[model samples]
Target: MQGFALYPFDPPGDIAALRADLRGWLTVNQPQDDVVARANCWASFDAGFSRALGAAGYVGMTLPARYGGGDRHLLERYVVIEELLAAGAPVGAHWIADRQTGPLILRYGSEAQRERYLPGIAKGELYACIGLSEPGAGSDLAAVRTTARETAEGWRINGQKIWTTGAHFSHIMLALVRTEEESERNAGLSQVLIDLDTPGITIRPIIDMAGHHDFNEVFFDDVLVPHGALVGERGQGWKQVTAELGLERSGPERYLSSHALLAALIDAAGPDPDPAVASLIGELTAEMWTLRQLSMSTAAKLAAGEDPMVEASVVKELGNAFEQDMPRRVQAIVDCAWEGSDDLARLLRALLIASPSFSLRGGTREIIRGIIARGLGLR
Candidate 1:
């Protein structure tokens, strides 16, 4: 009936029902103690709230039900996550674990590994953080110098990871470390699961411009993890991490991190906004809708058991650009006389402070563009 079929983005009735249920639950259970703090949205780490979400069976919706997960489709998970972020719920505590780590374990971890971690993750009791970017290797993961050497006891890890968000509060770290020195860059790397409380490990806080301590520098000094801690296989880290980054880059989180601020901007601008303000809102909303479709397409691919690496990179690159641009656009449009209603002023201020990090986190714009170029065979 058509030359080209429309790509599906709208959820089915069942999925719509799931979204409604989650929205209702959030209305009843979302924290009211600090609205400004909640404005951080997905970045607001609240362990107690995380546990509550887990108790509601909302944490690990896509993993195997045997591991205490809901065993729902990835699209369903996407629905839940987007609703949570849109509501400005505190999902930071279990975000990484549920989003990528659980899936990583399911795909590559041994049965024992999955059994050890998946249940707790589904329960939202065990928190995990990614130990990817280092001081010297931010987006260039191939330059990672953190080394895990073979020892009689196990693998002894020694190195530092920077910009490890939620590291301080997390129970475990899925760290990418170099297991071989002779191989070329990206060939010798491996991922290791390390207990954050292991001896000789240090976590130093890195306060952001907003004075938030979400990011941290984690140092491992002769820390020994059992051989069982290795995920997938040694020297296969580059492959594993590349897959994980696709998961990291394409989620609703990439685009929705600043959504609370966008909502606040609209609320502050009021119903009948100026032409300039209306134009700004219209542009941002259109961009967000486009990005959401792209992101959901990627999620659908994941549900279909396909890796949308190239598509994910595209979404991330564009989404990061839009997110980073939003704060400045709002600042330019809004009048200085328009003081916000409720916590709009505070959320706007926080968004301004945190905007600089939009392109840096996940992957830098330069790095993302490079990935896009490679994907298009333009490199």
Candidate 2:
């Protein structure tokens, strides 16, 4: 194909084959109980499950075959993610790598960088974390103070990154740093890959409001990285980072997080759906389907080499809000006890406890709203 600009694949394009294959594969090789364990703990800690996903060829579906990938369509990756989330599969171990870093690196990294990192990412043998947020820089990405200066060997990095999810265990941290001081907030910034074991690097797990240490604060003191560590052109981090955020924000993951409890609530309605409850479930399901379509379309746009920035923002804003509110609805439907002997009760117990952090994690509501306004030309 000379270019995909003229003909983008249809959203949710011909997923029948992929769906059937994934179903069969998962049926025979479903994850162990430890894979989908809920609450403060997750599958991210399970090396076995991560390896199994790699072995099963489900880790980096969209990457090229040379990198241990399946070379599947992006929509196929969508199907895989949907299956895992719907099944409540434990995927915490490789989630960040599979979700963001792999795709980000594949798109902007040098050929050597791609060859070096993508293979292990494909096999789920390597883990990666993003170092974007800091204690004072949440949502205002331009405020990140981490600095990297040219050194005889390469670059010397210094400063701290906070709210780096899974940093405690990740092998690599792809961090955004100020390459040179500029009067403009977004000027002279870049993204670089840092080895977690580099000299003078310290990672401290920060307990989230959820009372879990899934996130961390990483301090880098003169951590040296080769010049190749930069993912894209230096001073383009402002642009590259936003593009990466589009991928981060637009996906099934945005709304699928609360699906288990939503399904449970419908299950509690019994043999005959309660008219009111049925309508509520219908509304939620319709929203999920719509978000899925929008997200799929955004991927198709990206594959066609067109920026789906606006569409991605719409998906992120709506889908994240929808997912964030699902647990609140669950809590409102019944008492705080959630003692009913039903599937909804069990799922609600978990989702309710986990709901509060949903909005704050990926992109805060304020950040998303600003993006939406800018996209709409209302800002």
Candidate 3:
């Protein structure tokens, strides 16, 4: 189908209602203090907050109603995600499960798998992380060496995954492993679900330069999982994961991580504002708005069951650039010290330190651009 079919990114009438309801619910339930919300937005790991969100019917907005989901359109979910990120709510706890995992299970999982996992996920009680990146294979997923050997009992996985976000706090891991022997890169790959508490598995936290501990290195030394743990067909991991990456890389989260900082910059500038600062903010805002429209279009494609790899890559590349650029550009134009007005300064300092990873996560800029190039038939 042509991209123009999803041309308009404007929210539908129901989507507007969703936005209003979510906004009102968040105002009453989430932290009223701007700094707290600003600091937490999507990155803060708060299980209780996630549970609250799930209970409020905001967690699984798109999954079928049969599996405890809201059975709404993807755009409805998009609105809730936008509000959460804009408020900087502590959504990290259930972000992965709600965003991609639930859909993955709904799409590829068996009846039993869906029955067991989707309900907990919709309830925000089950947390999962992607086990794709490794020490040698971060962006080049085909280079992954993690192997899962099938056994009479189950699959024995032996490999290591690095930079697994929220792995320490997660209950399950959807890991991509090589299941076929001597197969070339991108072939023989399969995705497996493993319980984090299973014996023979170890997790060590990787503290970032910002002193945060969300990243981790997970080791699987003959870790065993039941056959039910496999997500899809045995040797179709590459296909499944690529489709999943379309879900992972394209979203409001890709662009909204530093949104709090952007708002803070405006506050710091006050009325009249510096002409240079206003210009910079206006430029960034315009870029963000364009990216949002592109992102909404991508989401619409997904809603229509199309794997918009090229479009998703474009959004991710441009979104990452904007996210990484916002803090540095703001710092160049404004006072970044933590003194004087504390709110904006604190938000700026937090984001300034966190900005470096904006492009690194959700696939690096280099890898994203490569995907875009290939998508454009330039390769």
What are the lDDT scores of the predictions, listed in order? 0.85, 0.77, 0.86
Poorest 10 consecutive residues of model 3 by lDDT? 1-10
Query: What ranges in model 2 sit over 4 Å off?
Result: 1-14, 32-45, 182-184, 335-343
- Tens-digit per-residue lDDT, 24-137, candidate 3: 898888866558356536668889889999999998878888899988778878888988998888899999999888999998998999998999999988999999998989
Overall local distance difference test of candidate 1: 0.85
Question: What lDDT, from 0 to 1, does candidate 2 have?
Answer: 0.77
lDDT of 2 at 140: 79
Over 2-84, each residue of candidate 2 has an lDDT whose tens digit, in order, gives 22122344535567876787778767666555222432233236667777878888899899898778798776787788777
lDDT for position 8 in model 1: 64
RMSD of 2: 3.8
Evaluation by TM-score, superior candidate among 1 and 2: 1
> Among all windows of ten consecutive residues in candidate 2, which has the lowest summed lDDT?
34-43
Q: What tens-digit string does per-residue lDDT give for candidate 1 at 1-379?
A: 1122224655444986898889888888888766666555767788899999999999998899999999887777888998888788988889899989999999999999999999999998899999998889876778899999988899999999999999988999999999997766898999999989999999999998878889999999999999899999889999999889889998888888888778877887799998898899999999999888888887777667777777788888888888888877877776542445556666666777777887888888898888877767684
TM-score (C-alpha) between model 1 and the true structure: 0.94
CA deviation > 4 Å runs, candidate 3: 1-6, 10-13, 32-40, 338-341
